[model samples]
Target: MDWSKTKTIFILAFLILDIYLAMEFFELQDKSDYAIIQEATIEERLAAEGIEYPDDLPDDINNSFYITAKSKDFTIEEVAKLKDQTIELPNVNFEEDQSFRTLNMILDKPFPLPDVNTESKITQFLNDNIISGELYHYWYTDEEMNSIICIQSYNSRTIFQSKDDHIGMVVLHLNEDNEIISYEQSMLEQIKEVEEKEAAITALKAIEALYNKNYLSSNSQVVKIEYGYYTHSPLSNQQILAPTWHLTVEKEDEESEDFYVNALEGDVLQLTE
Candidate 1:
């Protein structure tokens, strides 16, 4: 064998191997350093005030982390407990106007008649009945223009067998071209002034029936209750103050349960059970 030739070949092979190993080592080192920096940044931020980050972080970590970090006063266990207490709206019927056909009809055709005709009918109806209030107009866009002409009567009264009740709202809907589509009348009668206390009491009673029936536990505690007016066209002008109630109930496993309940006419509208 030629010693020089053999030595040269071995040296070149060793150099090539060394270069490959160096590249691999640098790649691994770069990856390790990147991971360390990321970890250190997270730890430093979380440990600044002894704040504990959530163990099972959500995929959207930036938003969740911000919320958790801002609520540093809460411990990890406290946050877990809070999460457990949050109620899921699994049984709520959130579908408003479940009959899509009704909605589709209004959207499909050009508004049937002129807005003036529909508005006049509504105004005359209110005036003849001596319903005192303001009238407003609204428009919606489907494939074509749709309009809603509304008449809202503030406070009024009626007598049914010597019983006096408050009537608070009246609404009318007109199509895009100002054609009458629908009207709604509220059942509350002769309301003098809309007071929160009166509305809350009404809401509580309405909610209680639903709670006892199927929406909530009989022993559920009503933590908060609020009531206010809600207007919906294609329904009635008689707007009722919708009452919302927040409740906490005890589960069989001793977990605290939280949920919201909307009660109207002895029926639960939206309930998280």
Candidate 2:
């Protein structure tokens, strides 16, 4: 028996054993970690993304049931009332966006907004130059209150108790002197009541749907889910505001995606940013 050859064989055998054991250890560890993660509850998952469970979630939501809600609309009388304000602007140009049914106005000379309170300014502007309606609510204004003014539609029954639900299609852009430089207004031609508004699915259910469809990451959290109106176009210049469930889901890195689910029909509406 050569002692040197015997020592080499022993060394090789020990190295192989060590490598096999290390591989087995890692495989076991991986499975254990995955099992722990898979056992996490929805709350736990949401917590990981720094989101809290919503307090007003319904106990059990039925997809088939319906809820009555009103859509945003303006009547001929309302339009005439707005036009009756006798808005005066020299060399003002108007262009219509066919897709959104919004009239984009560009002013040759900016009109100075009132230096009074924001509410008063808004009221005066609507009464003096633009339309005034109960449906439009003051949504947002900057600290200076001169750069931008956002107004959204709201109804008592359908407005969700979430900030995300307040995004409006009506916007007013102003100059440094709080003057109206330009504005985009949604032109709704008629008013009609929707009697057959269907009940929307719950926010949690919407999140689950996104997760199951792989649209949401398991590492993501449900940030916001609110009832709102999504603009849908059936054809050119024919725009309809459909009741929708808007969801905002985010990952730990804060990357988020917006999803709109048709509340009445329970269908996902395709959106373009």
How much lDDT does each candidate structure score? 0.35, 0.54
Clashes of each: 26, 2
| Model 2 local distance difference test score | 0.54
Q: Could you give candidate 1's per-residue lDDT for residues 136-227 as a string of tens digits?
A: 22221223323232323222111110001113233344544564444433233333333233223344343344445554443333333333
Which candidate number would show the highest TM-score if scored against the true structure? 2
CA error at residue 91 for candidate 1, angstroms: 43
In angstroms, the error of model 1 at 131 is 2.6
State the lDDT of candidate 2 residue by residue for 105-138, as single tens digits. 5655676766667666765665466544344555
Alpha-carbon RMSD, each predicted model: 25.4, 12.2
- The TM-score between candidate 2 and the true structure equals 0.51
Candidate 2 residue pairs that clash = 66-199, 67-199
lDDT of model 2, residue 45: 60
Find the candidate with the highest lDDT and give its number: 2
lDDT of 2 at 90: 43
